[model samples]
Target: MSTLPQIEPTGATGEVAELLAEVKKNMGAVPNLVKVMAGSPALLKGWLALSGALSDGVLAPAIRERLAIATAEFNSCEYCLSAHTYVAAKVAKVEATELEAARDAKSADPRAAALLALSDAIIRGHGKVDRTVLADARTAGVTDGEIIEIVGNLALNILTNYLNNVADTDNEWPLVKPRTHS
Candidate 1:
């Protein structure tokens, strides 16, 4: 059950129909989050636009998926956790152990670990991270552009996480429960 109505692709019309069509074309299905977001076509459009732009960002797909997993876990948004976990594993080819590690804002790779740490700090600190966090990420070889993209990815994940939390969006992907409540 969801607090918000999940707009059915079959019933959509005009801009909403076109947007849903695009989502389906790209993803092969209309995810519940996107369907719920379709309640506001503008919001759905904004999400699609940002997502498209971020796909061209310097961060690799695996890193982006890991960030989404970490953010979803932090927010205790089961919908996003499940969705991202599916994509991380099936599409990004992230290892099972790495997916679990991401839930704790951790990674085996030093560079990824640094970014996860920064993401955790940003979420916990509400964007006012300590200087040492930035220093650590730089020490791990994260460039300024990477840092900016990290923030952008975090923002994108947060939007979906918060939306699902508020909507109590039903999980359409394989369920991946959050280990802790935020």
Candidate 2:
């Protein structure tokens, strides 16, 4: 039971059309992923609300995307990795080099490097971390507040990462750096 759904555009009316409108009004287009999720009206609505709220969270847009990419990468969720990598580069201003490093485990940005490490630790189910990781995070200017937010943000990505893995959602090519093939 893959997550992808075959949609009938004409079938979209009433509640479904309204939902599509909501997406289009905000995103200028309704993404295929959202349309697939919309198969369950409640799920579509639930994720939409969560997305809206995440949009308003204290984390910078770039950091939020970074967390998402790291989680997806660690989970080996190509679906989420492809999607967020695009957003990170296109909308969130994440650098390609940083994203590549994250994928290859060679991250360069100190703050993002710390986050990539944290993401790996969490994904690998590491029992504990050395004090130096925390020290690195501090030196990278990641506040305790940000750390808490990172955990919460990573949780959000975990949900979607797992969903996408289970779903087998079709790839949407990179909108950021053309031909880079993230």
Candidate 3:
């Protein structure tokens, strides 16, 4: 059987565990991705720190999660889609059906559908978003700064999704409802 590629740790000692402990201080549990990537506590810590900052940033919770889930889905990273979908439901309290539909559709909230479509556009590439798309996005309430932030958010998801896919990180904990879906 084939397996995923993972960068093994040369040596992980109490330090890795300490990083886990630190992460737990903020979050009740260090997510499985963090644990596996903890193969290098520094790497794990960096990802967690950056993730934490983005998550806690000025962006609205729903918006951040919308971008994350959309990116994960477009990338076809099942693991990431599951993980972020759960966070969106649990931490962000976003409705599950809505999140699911948003992941599958270009525009989640039809009202902001045009602006919302930008996440997918970033994943596909700038070409997917032309002058007309920009105009539509603006009409849908997206701003220049938000467009830039959306790119950053999608880039972040691409990083984490690729990392998780490579690690084939075990689903150490249960995901949110309907856990088994693709």
Candidate 4:
């Protein structure tokens, strides 16, 4: 059960309704997370603006989706993990093994692997990443623009992950359990 009211598009009015309409047009449905966010019209609008802007960033769609999953897994946000896993498989066409690797932040592609490592470090370090980490990403051929975009994407995931964590949002798709380590 969501801690916040899940505002349906039909029930919403004004800015909230417009935002829900946009979400439906873009994603084919108003996801429950978005519905929860709709409780605050400003939050929904801000989320949509940030998401739309970052969608045009330099990262490939699969890589972005993979990062989203990795962030969700790292944060133990079950809602985001399940949602992004669906997007990764159905929308991004990421392979099963690749999806698993991505969830672990260990992509097979060297460049992607580097970015994933940086992303994990950013989360673990709480954005106080070490200089060596940046150096490694650069050595792995991550450009300045890519690095900025990586942080942006990470911030985006953090918002959704934190929101889901706080809201205890119900998993609307097949549930993805948090990855356990030995």
lDDT per residue (tens digit) for residues 71-148 in model 1:
999999999999999999999999999999999999999888988899889889988988888998898898999889
Residues 89-168 of candidate 4 have per-residue lDDT tens digits of: 99999998989998889988898899899988888898899999999999999999988998999999999999998999
Model 3, range 27-95, lDDT digits (tens) per residue? 776676666777666677777777777766556777787777777666666667777777778888888
Query: For candidate 4, what's the RMSD?
Result: 1.5
TM-score of each: 0.98, 0.77, 0.77, 0.96
Model 2 Cα lDDT, one tens digit per residue, 78-182? 767788888878888778787776564346767667766665665555435566766777787768777666667776777776666667666564532212232
Candidate with better TM-score, 1 vs 4: 1
Query: Which scores better on TM-score, 1 or 3?
Result: 1
Candidate 1 residue 96 C-alpha distance from true site, Å: 0.6
- Who wins the TM-score comparison? 1
Q: List the residue pairs that clash in candidate 3.
A: none
lDDT assessment of candidate 1:
0.93
State in Å the error of residue 169, model 3: 1.0
Residue 135 in candidate 4 has what lDDT? 98
How accurate locally, in lDDT, is each candidate?
A: 0.93, 0.69, 0.67, 0.90
Q: What is the descending TM-score order?
A: 1, 4, 3, 2
| Positional deviation of residue 156's Cα in model 3 after best superposition, in angstroms | 1.3
